[model samples]
Target: MKRNKRKSDEMFNLDDIKVYMQMSAKDKLYWLERVAKFLHKITPSKNKKIWERLKERGF
Candidate 1:
């Protein structure tokens, strides 16, 4: 039998958040900021810094 899930404005767990961060750093940072916004946490404004760092690593 299949179970039904409830729909609520709940936040993802830390593990899920980590998974998001494991995405390409640029994408990771973008999602990180979005999740933070949902949880009212502080996150950097731009992903430029992350992109620059990745570029420095020759990504």
Candidate 2:
């Protein structure tokens, strides 16, 4: 029998949670803020519809 290996993208480890749990309160908040900013940058804005309409009219 052969064993299967997980690809890097498909691999997940619980050690990350353990490390997070051991972080200081200040460190945790700092990481939280960083994550929030990252998410905000990746997300689209609420004015998407207006942009779409303008593009459709050759703007």
Candidate 3:
């Protein structure tokens, strides 16, 4: 048996959006916060000005 893995750049389909839309408000907020934190952790802090701006914006 063989498996076909998805490419990293593949876009989410309507079904995926529909599933997300069906989630409760609380669940949606949880996921949003999780993604934000993950992005913050991965972002490089090469520019002090940008980091200060993000902090000022409450990111």
Which has the greatest lDDT?
A: 3
lDDT of each: 0.63, 0.75, 0.77
TM-score of each: 0.32, 0.57, 0.59
Instruction: Report how far off residue 10 is in candidate 1 (Å).
Output: 16
lDDT of 2 by residue, 1-59 (tens): 12355557866445666678889999999989999898778768866667779999999
Candidates by TM-score, descending order: 3, 2, 1
lDDT of 3: 0.77
| lDDT, model 1 | 0.63
Instruction: Name the candidate, 1 or 2, with the larger TM-score value.
Output: 2
Instruction: Say which prediction, candidate 1 or candidate 3, comes out ahead on lDDT.
Output: 3
lDDT per residue for candidate 3 within 1-59, as digits (tens), equals 12345468866555567778989999899989998898888888776579899999999
**Which residue pairs collide in model 2, if any?**
none
Supply candidate 2's per-residue lDDT for 14.
55
